[model samples]
Target: MHFQYCPHCGKKAERKQIGDEGLIPYCTQCEVPLWDMFTTSIIAAVVNECGEIALLRQNYVSQTNHVCVAGIMKLGESAEETVIREVGEELGLKVKSVEFVKSYPYEKKEMLMLGFRAVAEKADFVLSGEVDAAEWVKLEDAPGLLREGSIAWQLVRAVKVIFDDHTLCSQFLRDYVDLPYMKGIRPEDIEDVSEQYVTLFAEERNSDRVKRVHVGGGSAPFFLVSLIEHKTAPDYNVCMQVFRYMVYIWETYEKEAESIQKGMAKREDFLYPPILPIIYYEGAKSWNVPRDFRSRIREGSIFEKYLPNFEYYLVPLRDYSNEMLMEKKDEISLVMMINKLQTAEDIVNFRQLPGKEIEEILKDSPEHLVNIIANVLRAFLLKMNVPVPETERLTDKVREKKMGELFENMEKMDIQAERRNTALEEQRADEANVRANEAEKQAAEERNRAEKEKKRADIAEENSIKLLVELCQDLGASMDAAMQSLRDKKDMTMEEAQKKVEIYWKEPTDIPEKKNSPNG
Candidate 1:
């Protein structure tokens, strides 16, 4: 949601240069950026086993022509779930299987519409109140009922091709291969003789096989195998896995030929299809695993001529930056951008992406894709602890385009956060000062106690000295005796003892606290 004021602190946002995103409306207080928001919905071309499509007459959408079963996606429901729920609610038919066709971006309504090819059992029309009428039309004639080149038409056409194996295979080859032979190949010229090889690792592998008819001067049509392996992490056995799958495909083709009693499996003239191996890695970690099947073999270089060598093409998502991804401006890139966000901070800061950049990313995207992306982003934000009300404010701010006010608001929030931080710091400093003052007062009290103890010791020494001299004089002993007593009792040097005796003998009457002495 584009923010004029920071939703967190209710302050105006500020335009600040944040990383590679350039200038963004940064909430200085909460330090969060506003994210883009959109509504998501689904439309489905409902088909039955009887080669007929269930079309609806909704006056709200189109009065004259019929429309597919469509409805807005509800919160907490996946796109597929929404399709199934809508089909059941609007046309009273339970969906058997749903195959995704493509997304349509309805920018006019600011919603994304995901198109699907839903298969349901043929039944009588049990219409909902919203639908005026519902009827089953043959698959071949279904497109003519809807407006040409419209979203519904395209979806039906795609479904028709998908149901017809020959047409779908030929269309896939034409779009995938760059060879000149593909130009002359028609839908009827292709055969759906694909013998898929499934393994325990099939969960990680998406393999497709199609046989193309020989055009102009060729002898017969040959099978073309394309293997697309999806990897979420680096694996050393990936080469072995590809090699095993390729071997299985070749073995299957050989057995089929041998069973038919036509082309000999071991014959030199026997033709085999080209096998293209591709590895699509979307892991966050670096892909450091060996790229070639030969790399897995010991001493592969020495036996290079005998050993098979082939490398898979790697498409790493981590190689693309946000700018580069936005430049691509496709559904894949949009999804990748969402995947690139890892941490909580990264998730929260996604809203800080520039509005112009978002517009450019979704510029030519289908109408349904906008809503899909919006739904995905909304889910991500909600899971990341973003508030519900803030998520609803997503409008194309790039069209309204207010940076100064946004920036000003964000700056004010930043100022408020800074002020709070400053206040907290000052309070801590004041507490520290109080602690220091208490310590100084304690030190002063200790010094006073020490001084009083020293004074008492001095007064006791004076009284003792005077008593020693008086005792010596009364006992008729010489000054030497007093000095000897002082030296023996006080452990003083001869000189110190003599000096003490002389001072006490001369000041015997001036002695302080004379009665307090032991021998007074």
Candidate 2:
């Protein structure tokens, strides 16, 4: 920038030319150097367990389809931390692990771009406001979505190299274990554990995955992690069924443990290891089921408090977002928030052009997330009584920049139609009142016109008295009769009235008959 005045001292600045630097401005009153400053930013390729690459669509920067998650590095933060924070802030996904890929000079923004590859456990995400859309694209489809030679593409290519090599894949997967959810569990402990540590009874299905988890550096125990989508009413039998599973796990594990103990494995010498059962519930409603075995016993029975209990950890998705899940930062929490709102219009708004209230939920949401929202909106519209366009039409409208105009027009038209439907009587009454007022005005105008003509006749008759008297004498009629004839035929002029009188001039019958014998 070329500054004409110094900000430090209120004095005019002068341009001083240096050897290679083009005319630099300086303040003569106080020494001040003017230089252009640019932002330092980071970009990265974040991948999930399935090897799908995550791409982000920026709010203001890119006019294209999508870009990798990027942001300015905060002061004193390392490039790796910046990448991890950017992914978490924008997409709401915790980066399990991250590795530096490369760096480049971004000429357009005049900033340095540090690239990295981050791995996340949960592929599902919530988006922030700065990101318009996001998507997880496979390596084959990335070419069309990513701008060639850009830092985002360069980082993604590096991630692809790491995925291709088998040795690197195992090493990275082992290193990238998520510690946030699995507290105190290290990558080395998993290596020491073995799979299929539990065998099921004949009636019980033995196909599911079972692992040996060592807790507190103690003897390894066989654990069964079951995901249950339970929806039925909770009963006393539910607890007993869990107890039955525990019995099977213990009975089956003891047989396997003895063989391993006989083989003299260095792991554990115990004859029977404990079988810990974990039940993860995925239900729409909250978990209000009995937690203690005693709760399922007879309420008033004397032995109710003494019964043995079998309880397991229950994790339900519905409980967290019921009240304060509006943070929009938690992926499942945001979904629960929407379910809490349960309004079609809100779903449309949250999916398309989401605002500040639910900021973090949509900051990093992908276009596919929008598609799911669209489906939800469509389902709600189908159930609503108001007029709604076809699903395809609505989808097309929401996908473009003209959605605001289309929504406004739809609301306006709906309001107008509703008014027209409900106010027919009022409109008709108003029209009839206007027409009656107009008819009364026309009648009053006609009466005024008649009076005006009478007045004009009085003036014309007064002005024509001399002519009328002469004409009456010529026509052999009384002046009153001649005047009566003129008044009766008011459409004629004075002369025409006299001519008409000459045609009807007859001595009044009411007057005494005049004798005509003298003239004979």
Candidate 3:
């Protein structure tokens, strides 16, 4: 009868008797031919003191009796970690510095066995529930105890070769030792902005006597005054008060004043009460005043604008002598001029002086006041030291051009940085591609080697079987019985078969000839 069914679909069908015995059916759904399958396992070769190696006897399965302490490598664990962990759990002892030994294919299953030699620090021979018993047997004797043609025997042979090489032992130690203090960020790269500011500035208790107010709502005025003072004298605190007062006046005038006249009229309304009352009492000069009134100046108040020009207003105090000018000048004359010049400059620069009031003050002022005013004007102009109004527009255009150049340079820098990064990325990708290609080539070579080895092994097995069958037939034995006997003997090969055949055919003792020894 011939049977019809789809193995891939798991569907049954009507059966028919088949003529040929060798014909096999393929799965309809997957179009795959049926084949045998097997699984892979890992084994560990654990060596201890007394020159003995530890081996495990499995509770179940035939070949399991010939295995070493081993288990399946769990997810997220390495082969070495698995071996160490398994040894501790199965033997109730700690394993140190596990090493990889060798791997090979066995029967239908592939075995990657690791051989670890640790000085059995402490061990309690408590048989694990899964293992019948554990034993520490001598290296040479291990082969006899272990099941023939098993992974355990393979592991023993690998360990013997590894232990004999002292260079291999040194390399193993170099790979596993933990070196001291190898990692962290460097100290100099750390930044603390807040601490930097605190360290740079000098700290002092600020008093409410004459608090300075800034015009632009920042510490910029303080920064400017500090910079200027720092250049002049290292310990110049006197200018601090002067700059504070100037800032206060500028800010007050900007906030409250409409023009020079109105600002002067409302001078008493200034927030700083002391300076406001003193400045208000020292009233400005009037144009309609009598000649006698202009001639007789007050002790503190001086009509500075009544002078000939701005430069004359800045005359030093030493020029006005006590003896020569006492009859003509009051003792307070120099002080009053200093105060007037300072106040006038402050008010004028702040745009607090009205146009009509300035013109009238100029017309009515005396010669001395005019001279001082001229000097003060010159000092103010020199202090500014700016280009003329027409030249300033050209200077601004030049500044804008320089700024554009700076921006262009900055953009170029950004472009160069981006290009460098792109180049670096391309280099990394090229390196990765090269590495991937090398790995693939190496893998292909390894696969080719394995296939070659497998083909050689199959040929050897076939050769052994054919030679044994022929020898058995010559000896007048049945083909089926010979094949069964060959299959039953593990590790049977063509070499072993030939040896047995020769030994069986040898005559009983026609005294064998001895070879000439080296000593003889």
Tens digit of per-residue lDDT, candidate 2, span 1-520? 3467787786887887755887888776787665555678888788765557788877597787578888998999876678778898999998765655568787567888877666676567799988888888764345457775467765654442322222222222232222233345433433211122222321232212233454456665435334232222344455655666666656566656557666543355445555444443435455677676666667625786566655665544445434344442433343334333334444444444333444444456454443333333333333332344453465454334223232333332243444565467568877998898899999999999999999999888655654654566687777567766676645566667666556545544586877889768
lDDT of 3: 0.42
> Ranking under TM-score, best-scoring first?
1, 2, 3
lDDT of each: 0.64, 0.55, 0.42
What is the C-alpha lDDT profile of model 1 across 1-520, one tens digit per residue? 3678887789888898878888888788898875545688888999775558898888988978988998898889877788879999988998766656679987657778888777688998778899999999876556558875567876775553221344434543453344677666666776544323323122322333324465644665554443422346787887776676567667777887899886597788887655555465667899998798778989988888899988865657678676666664445555556656555444334556564666565566544344444444444333333444543333122122321122222111233444567679779988998999899999999999999999999999878877987798788888999899888887889999888887777534665664666865
Order by lDDT, highest first: 1, 2, 3
As a TM-score, model 2 comes out at 0.30
Sliding window of 10 residues with minimal summed lDDT for model 3: 223-232
Better model by TM-score: candidate 1 vs candidate 2? 1
Give the root-mean-square deviation of each candidate in angstroms: 27.2, 31.8, 38.5
The lowest-lDDT stretch of 10 consecutive residues in candidate 2 is: 192-201
Strongest candidate by TM-score: 1
lDDT tens string, model 3, 1-520? Answer: 2235654577644332334634455454555544333333456667654446777777584454556787767787766566667887777766643544455555434434444333344355766788777777655456557675466765665453221222222221122212221111122221111111211121211111121212233322211111111011122232343334444545553554355455654566544322210011122332222223223344313664563211000112223332322232321232223224333233232233232333333344343333333332322222233223422332232223221121121111233444567679779988999999999999999999999999999889767666766667677775455645665663556556555444443234587899999999
**What C-alpha lDDT does candidate 1 achieve relative to the native structure?**
0.64
Better of 1 and 3 by lDDT: 1
- Which lDDT value does model 3 have at 50? 42
Clashes per model (N, Cα, C within 3 A) = 23, 9, 29
**How far is 490's C-alpha from truth in model 2 (Å)?**
56
